[model samples]
Target: MGTDMGKKESLLFCLDRFLDPWFGYQLPYQDAIVDLLQVVIVSDNTLSVKEAALQLICDYAWPPFPVLEENFERVEAELRPDVSYAMHMDKEIETDS
Candidate 1:
């Protein structure tokens, strides 16, 4: 599982970097960014990484395009792959360790 942990950590780091506040910056590669986040959301990573990706989508990429909103349910499903959404906790759960 070491490789999984490493991959998870790398994805989280990328998300955290994307979470930073940007001022007056133009996104020439917005599609690429969205694609990366989508991949992370569907990957076998932990809930935290997927949640971070979703957060980035909602916060940074959603308002202008709005199409990303369509996959919110799918991204959320990663939080609780086996259980119902209502049965899950409100806080981010780290299952990689």
Candidate 2:
């Protein structure tokens, strides 16, 4: 499990490097950008990292692709459990009272 986690982190690092150059520049190909983001999101081992990368794509990537938007929605859905747990902790505490 540790080895797998290490590999996932390494892959994410490489992807970050690949994305760095394109951050400020205009994307030349829509398909390539979408494909790259898909790879990043799918390769992510943790929900937090996947959510962060998806948010980055939504915030930074230009000429918004529908496929990317769809991917974001899907990732967001996957993240709902974490979000709900974090946001509803107070409600749980109140219920226990």
Candidate 3:
């Protein structure tokens, strides 16, 4: 995914390390970030990428947002973040007991 896999990983790690502590664990992946932003960041109570980013950062003040593609300006507040953009997905891993 445009060589930005690391950034996505960082985002997921942030959410997991911070959010999971308070909200419980989840699949740490790009799709998680995208899904979370859609549900938490894109709120009617506020608008704009900056606002969404601010709220998101506030929500999980552990691992910070990394500077990479920084692709928020392209989207309108009316639009939603979709998990469909996450790339290189594999079937759910079955861990050995």
Q: Return the top candidate by TM-score.
A: 1
Give the lowest summed-lDDT range of ten residues in model 3. 83-92
Q: Candidate 1: minimum summed lDDT over ten consecutive residues — where?
A: 82-91
Could you tell me which residue pairs clash in candidate 3? none
Q: Residues 8-97, candidate 2: write the lDDT tens digits.
A: 556555555445665554447745755565555655457655655455454344433444435544545666454344334556667999
Which residue pairs of candidate 2 clash? none
Ranking by lDDT: 1, 2, 3
Best-to-worst ranking by TM-score: 1, 2, 3
1-97: candidate 3 lDDT, tens digit per residue: 1235455445545654655446665556644554446443323323443344444444443332222114444434343232111110112122322
**Per-candidate local distance difference test:** 0.54, 0.51, 0.39
Model 3 has an lDDT value of 0.39
| Best of the candidates, lDDT | 1
- Extract clashing residue pairs from model 1: none
Q: Which ten residues in a row have the lowest lDDT in candidate 2?
A: 59-68
Q: Is candidate 1 or candidate 2 better by lDDT?
A: 1
In lDDT terms, how accurate is model 2? 0.51
Better of 1 and 3 by TM-score: 1
